[model samples]
Target: MNTKPRQTGRGGPRGTKNLPPAPDNKENIDTQILRLEQLEQKFNVEGSNTLDIVYARQENDQHHATIQAQAAELERLKEIVASFHASEGALGPNITPSGSAAAGSTQDAPKKDKARKHSAAANVDDMALDERASKGQIGAESQPSGKKGKAPKPSAPTNVDDMAIDAPDGAAAVAGTGADDEGVSDTTAALARENAELKRLLAAAQAGPVGGPAEEGPAPGSIPRPKGSAGSDFNIQDAMGLGHGRKNRKNYKSIMRSCRDLVLQARIDWERPWAEVSAATKSKAFAVAEERHPILARFFNSWATEELMKQSVKNKRNRAYKHDGLEVPEKYAYLKANAAKRNPTAPRGRQAKLGRVDVARKRAEKKKKVATSSIKTKKDAKGKGKAVAPESDEDDVEMKQYAPSEEDESDCTY
Candidate 1:
């Protein structure tokens, strides 16, 4: 069979031409956002993404509502403009065309009163017609005069204190003239009452308790932050850090100190020495060692490790001093003495405790002791143990045997 490419329309998809044209970019973006929101709702992503999506949708809804309100207001304004235009068109000619005649006839005193009444009547008639048209009475007038709808008539206005009163212009004008000060006083009183209520509500919200007094609560937006709580404000960098599991850098020195204190406390509280109980209670806290709990084992192990590390460092430092042919510092003098004590042949005493400087002085003292012993021996030889000349054959033999050789005699003379 010969293979050939099947032709489709220029639109690229077979059934796409029948689909409604895609909206503008802004509308399409909104549609996509809505779809995404629905998807997010149906299959929620963990963490802050869900919260962000919700907040965005709420803001979008608020903006849309405000835009719709503004649009309705614009339409209402257009209708009012159209009504004003209609009224002006109907009344414009009557007012302007007769203006010059009225001015000239001002001298005709008798006709002036009639012209003024006609003008006043015309204005009243125009206002009445406008009001009737606005009130939807034009429909009533178009119906047959004899046929009236039996729809319930509007009841007379009530003068109850509970009901809000909407007085006509004449009534309102009369009230304003008669009780202007009273009206002003009432408005001020109402405003003051409203202000007090608002303050009370605000105080209650800040206080945290509904029944708590306003004075007891912290100032709004000024609540003291909880200790050890995470920060509220965050950024993209923080999100990245969280994704990778942010690390907390610890000061090992401080950690060692804290662990050491805890271990010491545990030992004291349990009334057992560290070495004796470490193996048995190593898996338990010192506080509750009898219970054999392992909660504090980690801390105990950390402290033990820190001690071992410290000993290792000390040994290394001592080795470094020896390698460099330098004397150990005074602080390490105790360690030097302790090591010497460990040897079986090492001498002990104040000299053992002495540092390198004192040990050198001790060597000089030993030399002086040898010189003093030699001086004592020479004095004893000259005074009490004097030599005698040989007289007998046996004495001569002894003399010959004990006497210094010729080489010793020469060395003695020197």
Candidate 2:
């Protein structure tokens, strides 16, 4: 048939613009899809990285917080220990912590406390024994001295009054024979007076009618009778009681002082750990001193003292070198230098004096003196040699109206 190749108009001539626009919409859709996929992937990657960073920061913060909490807890514990030690001092060593006892036992709390005290005393004795043994003080059976499987005999109570009385015998002898004879004479006089007083009292009793109970006298072996009957037995008893009371009070005061010393020692022991911790954390020697000696807290406050500041600087330097393996920065050096400047006694180089203001003042004074001298000379010259009187009388000579004397010519021969 003559209509063989009817134009289908699908594939036109090569390189023609009508060659089917290359599926532009599909290609564009594909390119847009690829860009969107790439953007999604990038967003996912960045979001994951940001989340990782956030999680890492959170972890770091938690770690730091935990460390801080631990440090705070340690400090709190130290404070608690210190408070306990202080309270223990006010309370005697026999005190027990609350809630340390249980019910239903036949022994009451006081008894339990007593038993505990005895147990502690026994332990202390054992420790002392151990110490003695370590020092080669053991006996035949390795028992401590004064403890040979038997209780020690009770010791007689020592009378301090008797000791004091005895102590004066040697002193009295050293006072010389004259003083010793005077003391004996006084004793004899006191005895004679006492005898006369007793006799007078007996006479008074006899002069009064018989029955008045014969007036009992002081017991034998009591203090030597006083010279006057006014000194009654009651006086001696009262004096003895007063002396005993004074002794008791003195003993009580001594006990209190001892307790205070023990409390101080306990406080020192309790604060040792705190001092170490403070030194480790703050790297400050003052903290250690304050922890060790609470009484010195006020003194340490003004750590600006030259010695203390120097020690602190040394501590910081050592800490920096120890922990960070680094030298002190130049900024710190400048601060230290300024501090030294503020303290006149701080060690400094002689070079610091080379450009001092004192030198400048001296130089300025010399220059001013020179300028004043020059001005004075100009003033003197401007006076026009008008027979200006000499400043000194020695320079002003009275020249008599006469020819040169013959003696002047004789002196000129030399």
Candidate 3:
């Protein structure tokens, strides 16, 4: 508001002219502030999506580890069951209801041998008592010799359990194991069978859907009747889509690998309660998909799948997709490669196949090492006297570089 100009030194403003130029640090601070502002703007727009991707990756890794552990546990259980069956088989064919050696002409010989052992043991005990008495280790009144006029009644066990233990090993073995074996074997067999069935279902679930034409009744006498009807003719390979006439080995490998991830995700999600599928769960599921197969990750997320399911569900009231009950997609329908390779005769993308992940650099390096090991072995053989260096500790060995190909934006949903 001042109309009069302020008077200063010859440079116009003396204090301003003398002031030092802005420091390098001050310019850097300003640049950093601007970058931070831009970053904050980005976070406001895409924060949810970014967070979801991270969560999904973690879920996928955890799922894979769990499935691997389960498979190992199942294998161990099978081994235990097998050992039980073998031991039961080897227990000898002469087992009786009481679990004792069967009563036959051969049984008398064992009884005779046991009687001799008892008499020998009794004589040894008598000898020990006489020696103890002579040495004044026992009181004369307690000596067996003092009661010589009457034969000592054989010592009897006070309890049934004691009597069982006192019996011949063969007799006790039979008595203890006979009934228990039947019951235990029955229970174990049933449990093993159930576990096997469950494993089969899990493996099947991870594979592609079964493919076969509906079976019609066979003509009269067209085939011999089996004792039992085969409920489902499909095998695991058929379920895995390997039953196709022309095989694409690459595609098969790809499907198998992706199927493992899908199965793992399904397992983790399926265990949680269906009612708990809120925004958080939805975000997690989306993130997990994005972490692995970014191309199809969005398709399996809550928003995408829920929208897809709305039209498919019989009841409109049940609009939400059950997070835990997700199934592996039938085909890799979303992939550009799969879509391009589809048969012209069939609907576009309908018959699309799964695409394999690009082979990683570490895997390629491993293959190279394997190939070169033979040459090294030949050299070692030719120079037997040459001192070879001890191998470096595995801890000190450099780990291979690994880079997984990220899916391009062609498959992006949003």
Candidate 4:
């Protein structure tokens, strides 16, 4: 049986009273059609609005469901993480998979690892079972795999906040102190460096350098040099010296004869200093009487010993033999000459540095000589009735080429 309304022959509902039949006139029919079209359009607009409301409500319900689902999932994840964290400390040291309260706390490493994993897995399963039980999905008393499945108690405190807020003044004061310390440290380092440099400079200034010996004169406490060419040192070459107004040895024959006479006089003894024999030591000692040649006579033992020593020094120095004035018939001249020059490369460059005191003494002596010569020139000028005024200091510096720079007047002892 249909629940739809029965239509009478008048084309209306049966529940209503007898209704009028619509007029069959063209105008009235046209009016009724237009009214029907208007009603249909109104119904269509109302249906469209109802459909829009239904769609909006459906979207809102879906959004709310999505939010609830996300909340549930977040709760689940939180529970898993909380259990994971809690299980680490909650599992007692005695827990194990085949638990009968476990044997002891000090178990093997592998056993501990297995126990840790099993306890964590059991805790996770217990959390899931409890969760399911609250939703009536699982029994609340459902047992996990192991008997000792409960979490252990944490050893540390449960409620302690690690991070804290610091006071602004305290932080700023600390920063300022750090900066001051840094600045002070830098200043101290700089001052220390400067102090070291100053100390070095002061020490250097106080202890001045020592002057070396001079280059122009002999050293003190040394033997007075022979007044002429290097005595007994015949291989004189490139002598960078002032020569001290000495002459070359031009006559050796007369010198030996003079030595003989001095030996006879018994004056040339070991007690006499070499400086006393000034007349004999000069390079050109022409004061020796050349009238009598060196006779082949027996000489004094002392004189002969002195001459032998001099000859030995000459031989050691590789001195060249001179066959000029002296006659040496005792030995072959050719043999002596060749023997002396055999080791031509024996002698080396001289390195005789003079002392500062000796150099100063020589300079004073030269000044004294210049003064004496100037006085003599003035006296001679006075005698000639002429004014002798030197044009310059250079003009007053007179030097004779071969002048004998006679030392203290000879006592004629030698």
Q: Between which residue pairs do clashes occur in model 4? A: 90-151, 90-152, 91-152
Q: What stretches of model 3 exceed 4 Å from their correct place?
A: 1-49, 93-278, 281-414
lDDT-superior candidate, 1 or 3: 3
Cα RMSD (Å) per model? 34.3, 43.2, 35.2, 57.7
TM-score of each: 0.18, 0.18, 0.18, 0.15
Which runs in model 1 stand beyond 4 Å of their true positions? 1-49, 96-414
Give the higher-lDDT candidate: 1 or 4.
1
Q: What local distance difference test score does each model get?
A: 0.42, 0.40, 0.42, 0.40
Error of 3 at 380 (Å): 99
lDDT of 1 by residue, 89-153 (tens): 55434333222223445356746533433332224334334444565653452333354675545
Please give the distance, in angstroms, between residue 257's alpha carbon in candidate 2 and its true position after superposition. 30
Q: After superposition, how far is residue 284 of candidate 1 from its true place, in Å?
A: 45
**For residues 1-414, could you state the per-residue lDDT of candidate 4 as single tens digits?**
889887986888775575576565566446644754565575565334322333345568879997776666656655655554565456544433232235545245656444543443223334333334455544234435554867544332221111102322211212124343344334435545755665554454445434886575434433233335333232221121222333323224234434444343222332233444444332112112221223211222223324423433334233223433334445455656654653455322121111333444565577677777777889878676664553444322342211222221111111
| Candidate number of the best lDDT | 3
**Could you arrange the candidates by lDDT from highest to lowest?**
3, 1, 2, 4
Cα deviation of 10 in candidate 1 (Å)?
82
TM-score of structure candidate 4: 0.15
Quote the RMSD, in angstroms, for model 2. 43.2
Give the deviation of candidate 4 from the true structure as CA RMSD: 57.7
Give the alpha carbon lDDT tens digit for every residue of 1-414 in model 3. 887656587736446776898667467557645754565475564333433444654778889997887777667666765765565445434443222344454345866333332222223223333444555555333324446587645443333344336544323222234443344344445545866776676565455247897665554423222232121232223333344655544444443344333323333343234344466644554454444434333221233333222222312222232344444344534564654654457322211211111234454566567557756776777776654443443412333212212342233221
- Clashing residue pairs in candidate 2 are none
> 1-414, model 2: which lDDT tens digit per residue?
585444444655445655576565467457644754565575565334332333345568879997776666656655655664464344333322221223333244556544333323223223334444555544423333475688555332243233325533321222224433355335435545755665565454435334557555544443332332222222322322222677755543333333233223223222122333333223233333343334223332322111233333444455665696766556557655544544466323333332343455555566566667766776778767553332433211322212233333222210
Clashing pairs in 3: 52-287, 56-287, 56-288, 99-174, 100-174, 269-324, 270-324
